[model samples]
Target chain A: MSNCIDFYFDYSSPYGYLACERIEAIAAKSGCTVVWHPILLGAVFKITGQKPLTESPLRGDYAVRDFSRSAREHQLEYQHPAQFPIGAIAASRASLWLRDNSDPQLRAKTADFIHAIYRAYFSAGQDITDATVIAAVAGSLDIDSEALLLAIATQAVKDSLRIEIEQAISAGVFGSPTMIVNNEPFWGHDRLEQMERWISSGGW
Target chain B: MSNCIDFYFDYSSPYGYLACERIEAIAAKSGCTVVWHPILLGAVFKITGQKPLTESPLRGDYAVRDFSRSAREHQLEYQHPAQFPIGAIAASRASLWLRDNSDPQLRAKTADFIHAIYRAYFSAGQDITDATVIAAVAGSLDIDSEALLLAIATQAVKDSLRIEIEQAISAGVFGSPTMIVNNEPFWGHDRLEQMERWISSGGW
Candidate 1:
């Protein structure tokens, strides 16, 4: 219905952070807006009977290796966080709060918040599971730190994230870094190239 | 130790078939031999506590869609087999049988046999769970159908397939179409490009 691409991700996901780094530019090239939806993949995993790729034995080791390799290949800043698989409740809630409060002057602020959260977890190797860390990241962006910390605990922000997760599940999204263009789901950061081709060619 | 890429795959994987269609060309360009190993992912799943991608609700739906999209993207033929998740035991054993019988002229025949089996399972939509069907596929490839059928049934071929599965598991293989080069594992057909880059640059 809208001329926007749905980019679903979880703040704790390395692949999600990778997608966020490149998605906006990729979407802009196709003249589409990216609607970022930060959701809890742990909840989705429970429903899909799936576990994090980094939790499975061999895949866990391979994912850690690939995460850094992919970052190097893409020329992005990356470092595996010390406290991985951290709860992203604060970050997810803060992202929604920023989006809900967006004004003409603050239209780009939402993206800044998303990127800052990702950077904290991925690039800086900071433990982002704490609300204080999320608030600090927001505060660095000139946003009200105390207000963000308060907003993340608000019922509205929490419900908004829950609704986003539910919508993602209903949309057949079972993984983080899932991009949906014109309602077709392309799962994983690896499919970004294919998604770009689909957007440019209008489905080949 | 050899100038070869260890390509581990299961016959029932559409992505594996996609990899088979292009792996040889990719490997040839790198001046590397692709040593194909057909192992039962079902066995690996037992150890990893994983299930088929197609068995995970929304992911299952996404995988089927991605399979065809990937096929079209690669200019390869693909059809989701009617016998979804068909047993790959027969095909795995047949592949081992062909490798064991490889002579100077038959050195390349093993790959041919593997490709034919993939074609039967994916493009032809044939039920490859049956040893007879695998033998028939090999027969069409100018391989000895009767001998191939007999070979698949032999204890040697069965044990070889089991050993390959054990080796794959020991080598940290947890999914279909896992490419291992220089002791590094690159999982999925999606990583083919990354793997090629790794091969070309000899690691970054």
Candidate 2:
């Protein structure tokens, strides 16, 4: 098995944002690398017949409370996004474009771009569904904002994200913040510790 | 805001079984008592539009795997029941009957019966949906098996369980192993640690 963790997440997922903030440290502790795969939960939900957490009946209220409580437990900053559960298509496409960039420097900034976008939406309550908002977040991190905006709008980048979501669904990922280590899937941000234990113990 | 943890769970829920094995110590650590509420997820699912974890599409396979893996993580023995996702109506009724008994000693055996029923189903692969199976498990604990069976079969016991499920849904409990500490709902067994922190730190 590869010493890499495949981290699957949706930009609009609060748990996904929380996982992105903590997965790196958990991965580094066991000498493992994290491979981030940004996907659309909306697409996965179509097959899984699931709805957004905040839109569900009873779970909706608990999910909103858990989002901030979980973040505080991890000592991470979180604020409820004004417009949540957004499409996040532009941000997801931007992440994939950055990761697949030919330039190693831009590729290395993929994680940064992901964190920035998540922080912008979850911490600062920004509307990340807007391409310009995504571009501005990228620009703040020394990335070429205009290029990213253009790249995400291209059919190739959009298709790349579509394929990634399909692959994620095929791999048995039905939720955000799913971490796969050694081909075993752990879903939810709550499974991070279990995922770490699986890595440190070399599978239990 | 009571100094007690209202633990709502379904007998057929694997995570609920796992939580049952650990909640007391967590409660005791913070000088809190645990009030076990045996709920029917099937009823809640009717309103929440959720299916059993092991019945969902991609999540089904992962839930099956997570059941045993999570059990192992907690160092608890687990065997998947041959007839999974059983109704567990009999066990739930029996649990309520035991808890509401006039005799204090029989009322005290409520926890024992809860553990026995869960262990029989999850650890020993017994069909807890059967009233006779539930009775036999209760008999092993020195409880009056005949009386228990008769009690669980009564309209009163059945109504009690129905009312309990209604109350659980009213309180926003849509899943198994939901622990409500100080009126704050923490769903899933994985949140036990956060629940403990909430107890120890008096909320964040």
Candidate with maximal lDDT = 2
Classify candidate 1 by CAPRI docking class.
medium
**Residue-wise C-alpha lDDT for candidate 2, range B122-185, written one tens digit per residue:** 8988888887788798889999999988888899999999999999998889999999877799
Q: Write candidate 1's Cα lDDT for B37-137 as tens digits.
A: 98888888887898888888888888888899999988999988888887788778878877766554454688888888889888887778876787677
Interface RMSD of each: 1.1, 1.1
Q: Candidate 2 DockQ category?
A: high
The runs of at least 3 residues in candidate 2 whose Cα sits more than 4 Å from the true structure, single-residue gaps closed, are none
- Candidate 1 chain A worst ten-residue window by lDDT: A99-108
Clashes of 1: 0
Cα lDDT for residue A127, candidate 1: 78
Which residue window of length 10 is worst by lDDT in model 2 chain A? Answer: A195-204
lDDT of 1 at A203: 85
| lDDT score of residue A18 within candidate 2 | 98
